[model samples]
Target: MSITKSYSRPLDFKNGRIEMSYGAGGRAMAQLITDLFAAAFDNPYLAQGNDGALLPMATGRLVMSTDSHVVSPLFFAGGDIGCLSVHGTINDVAMMGAQPLYLSAAFILEEGFRFADLKRIVDSMAKAAFDAGVPIVTGDTKVVEQGKGDGVFITTTAVGVVRDGITLSGDRAQPGDKILLSGTIGDHGMAVLSQREGLSFDAPIVSDTAALHALVAAMLDCGASLRVLRDPTRGGLATTLNEIAKQSGVGMLLNESSIPINQPVEAACEFLGLDPLYVANEGKLVAICAAEDAERLLDVMRAHPQAKEAAMIGEVREDAHGFVQMTTKMGGRRIVDWLAGEQLPRIC
Candidate 1:
């Protein structure tokens, strides 16, 4: 008989708040996992109920990365905690020019989290992992008292293989390299903001959350000499570029009009006193490559479904101060400084 055969009870989610007993390693916690987590995230590996997963490793340079998701509202415009958790870590591993293989997720749930809602999140996550051709090989779960935990928090760790001859990093960008943005900016931030404040607008502001490994693979196939790869996340494109510029001892010059932003996102930033350049993004990425390869790289990016709106936003420059400046729509220039304060915390 299966070890979990005797474990059968519908989890009490209605009117039940998280208590210390839920986190305790006993019948209560076991029941919670058997009913809620194990049921929703069912998979051959997960169903095995082992402490860890044993698997085969691919031959090549190995790359691994981990990220934790705690985005507010749990569910949002484009995606929820489930898909975001998978995308965030997958992108991290892919940024290193790796093909992500396996994933492990750990969940921290607050007592009283609705079973229906939790199911939605887990199902979304499992589907993402499946679609990405990756598996959630192992996981752990813990329940905290109602007040002590958020609705849910997920930490995902991914392992992948780095394709030979494909090297990537932030410091690899060089002077005269071209900078390409995956697509429009600030979609993720505006979506979260709208939902948080109960605000509505004429044009819908959606988050640009997506998996980018396929896009990166396309670039590699196009023979582009990619020097660096970085996803513009919490601090947005401006911050990510600044970090790269400083690391590479170079400067950046951006064409304001060339960068793309959705109409609603632009208006929302104007109303909220935020800059789309500095707002958080989930689905966009920054690729720096040799100037000669810029056009070819752009061609590859534009051909991909995720990067159909790709644009060459800027170029690496020689600056003594390692500054990042932009040519505004008015034809005047302004220094794009590092973000001084948190624009939107808990965005990722």
Candidate 2:
């Protein structure tokens, strides 16, 4: 599409609302991309204005991950759907012990959505990418008829590179490996739940939504002895550990007292009749490494602000049944199974 005549007016970002034509392939669409997304996520790659970004290849193994964000309320205690979208996809790549390089975001905006709100989300996404040292190289936007879609939905795709000889996977966990958690769990789930349900606590709970690449890099700097790295997200810590157990053909034994759960989170879970073990976390990670290197890795992890609350919560064990058992504070042991059902839906 070519435009011979200059446009007369600029998009009224502060007072305007999204329109269907802004998503159609025409001057309106191009203007929206240029005035909104491009301005927010400015970079040489996105400046190309092409159908797809042309990224230069670099040495090392390539890692790519994609995630869709549908968090309700759009805004939350510590984050919104925008930054959440960036962090979620970046964490996925970081879980593989890769250094995130670039990102691409796509928006499914509902027609009549407020332009101010859209700008806020886009700006947040751009800031997240900038803070993480990654760029949104390419993106697409579409508008769905009003009431056909929610306020907005964002899908982010991230690409990263892992150095040669540095491999991490869920199946890499083995018997006698130590289990480590980056920090307290259930913060993200509870934060979102509180906002969605209008539940208030003595102290406000904030979502632990953050990118974990730097922490993963610090762990890798310690050594390649790191067996597996996973961010416990949707199903929370219990389901994540179960998955690792089944993947590595190993069972797990956890120390109930050692598993760190913030008092507020615990209280919220108790009141809500939810298990913190099964509540989702956005910023925390579960690392399984050789028993000998566990302390060493923990030292590296604790040195970072994100992992100051890191703890050796459990150990991988030899069990054909692949059960995840936790020794309770009450001097009893019980199963920590996968989340029974949807505890919190549309929680991101």
Candidate 3:
């Protein structure tokens, strides 16, 4: 029998709050899973009600990535913690040049959290997975005591497959390779900061949290000699580039003027005394490819809606010190060092 059908009373989603019983491995927990999570993320695999999902194996190299979302103020300008969790893990798999297939989510809900909010987050997560052609096949839930946890925290893991002959990694970059950015940087971080601090601006900044697998697929179809595909997330563009440089044992020369930044994001960073380069992003990506294929790759990236403003921001170079140097907009040279400390905490 279906778990939900076994329950005599329906959950009070409209005017209810989470309780410890919801995660106590009893009737309440089963009912919560069946009525809420299962109803929202309906899929054959999830319907099995098994301890773990049974997935059909696919041909190609498999890729798996997991991410935890704890962004303050669960809801933001363009997205919330739910969709952000989905996109974050999917982007991680896509960055490996994989086709994401399924997702597993685990939630930690604080006691006293409103059931209405939880439903919203789960529904949003389900929609994101559906739109991305991925399914949330299995998951677990736990409730913590109030004040012991945030309202809610979501951790998602995604699985994908990458066909043979497509090898992308951070260490594949070489001197003379071109570096490309998918779009404007720092949108997500600034958006969250503004909302958290209740700071209002004439032009509000929205988070660029989005699924990027389609963009990666388009780039692959263009047949460019791609080396690395990384979404600049927590550490933003500068830190991401530095990671690649260290992994590939190379240096980078970036054109500061060429990097894309929305006017509102730039203004907010200036006001907050934050550097956009070190700010976080959710939707944008950084690509490193052969210099000869730079233009071809750029064309394909720009063609995608997610990367319409893509640009070649820098180039890999030979440097024993593995430094990332940028030519300023005023024609000055400066070293774009690694982020010294945590710039924004709980920034997703």
TM-score for each of the candidates: 0.94, 0.97, 0.97
Question: What's the distance in Å from true for residue 101, model 3?
Answer: 0.7
Model 1 per-residue lDDT tens digits across residues 209-283: 888888888887888899999899888989999999999989999999999999999999999899988998888
Number of the top candidate by lDDT?
3
Which stretches of model 1 miss by more than 4 angstroms? Answer: 1-7, 12-19, 198-203
Give the per-residue lDDT digits (tens) of candidate 2, residues 84-189.
Answer: 9999999999999899999999999999999999999999999999999999999999999999889899999999999998989999899999999999999999
Candidate 3: which stretches are off by over 4 Å?
1-7, 198-203
Measured with C-alpha atoms, the lDDT of residue 230 in candidate 2 is 93
- What C-alpha RMSD separates each model from the true structure? 2.0, 1.9, 1.7
Q: Name the TM-score of candidate 3.
A: 0.97
lDDT of 2 at 303: 94
How do these models rank on TM-score, best leading? 3, 2, 1
Candidate 1 local lDDT, residue 337: 88
**Position 83, candidate 2: lDDT:** 97
lDDT of 3 by residue, 1-348 (tens): 665634358889899999999999999999999999999999999999999999998999999999999989899899999999999999999999999999999999999999999999999999999999999999999999999889999999999999998999999999999999999999999999888856645458899999999999999988999999999999899899999999999999999999999999999999889999999999999999999999999999888899999999999999999999999999999999999988988889
Model 1 weakest 10-residue run by lDDT? 7-16
